[model samples]
Target: MNAAATTHHHTSCLRCGRKLTSTKSVATGYGPTCTRKVKAAAKAEVVAQYKPHQVAKAEELIEQGGLIPLRGQIYLAVSSDGSQTYKTHRAACSCPAGIKGLHPCKHRIAAHILSLAA
Candidate 1:
């Protein structure tokens, strides 16, 4: 192939507008430093939306493999009792607390955490 045909044109970074040359950076649209900052900011936003206890529980659920990805943003969260599974999404969950709409449930929080990690 000719040099011009083989040459990869660098894309602008999504966060900083710097030219991205690395394959991973080009694919993700962010350079290494900007990628870290973007991910940290996203995680912080997710954490800020939930209570400390809820975030703790979500982390525990993730560590224990209690949250299983079903498809897309949907997940199957095993109940603490291990007797039931609830369909969960970042914004919605099938758990009782979620159904009642009192507040964001632990299952929902877990989904958000998992999404951010991905």
Candidate 2:
């Protein structure tokens, strides 16, 4: 017997008990008549509404060598280690400013400035 014929069959949606035309297993196949469509639509809506400003800020940081200087001799370094998903990791100079609870140090700021000039 074929695999499809061997599988157990359920003809109603698990969520709403409506007649099921298709399962959500396949990529492009029709899904459960109501809940599947609603869930998928909601997911798309959330993704579409993402903020562009935050994305642009990150790109600017990349262009600037992932380094920023705030005040005095403080420097900050931002790093990431993920393909599709980004995980921000920061490193700072070991200057007194950093050790005293201030963000970044002078070394990172200098590096960033040099990188920008070049």
Candidate 3:
């Protein structure tokens, strides 16, 4: 037998960071499987941190149809036709919260908060 005829391959586990030397891959990531696991973990981390507020709001919106949440920390309700439903955006002293340029109008906030409650 010639030692030089055979070459050694090195592989590592993604989760545990352990060295492996198996030609066949395992679900735990001995070689090729390892890369996929690593990528999946990274993708999950990104998705977890992305649009945290939006995620929360999505749940709330389902609850209160009339009550809408806004970026200015105000709540409003509009008709199905998209007309102003309520008065006074809470974040500002003004009676109209809908006009506020905040990221979400009161209607949006109310919808988000209500959905979460539901």
Which candidate comes out best when scored by lDDT?
Answer: 1
What TM-score would each prediction reach against the true structure? 0.62, 0.20, 0.22
* Cα misplacement distance, residue 90 of candidate 2 (Å): 30
- Writing each residue's lDDT as its tens digit, candidate 2 over 1-118 gives 4322222234553223456564442211123343344334433442253344433443334333343333333334443321111112223444345456454333333333323322
Q: Which residues of candidate 2, in runs, are more than 4 Å off?
A: 1-9, 21-32, 48-118
Where does candidate 1 clash, by residue pair?
A: none
Q: Model 1 scores what on Cα lDDT?
A: 0.69
Deviation (Å) of 70 in candidate 1:
0.7
User: Stretches of candidate 1 above 4 Å error?
Assistant: 1-43
Ranking by TM-score: 1, 3, 2
lDDT of 1 by residue, 23-97 (tens): 766654557775555346446877678778887777666544566566887987778776677899989989899
lDDT of 3 by residue, 52-80 (tens): 56434422322223333344435444433
lDDT-based ranking: 1, 3, 2
Error of 3 at 1 (Å): 96
Error of 1 at 59 (Å): 0.6
The per-model lDDT (C-alpha) reads 0.69, 0.35, 0.38
Comparing 1 with 2 on lDDT, the higher-scoring candidate is 1
Clash-forming residue pairs, model 2: 74-105, 75-104, 75-105
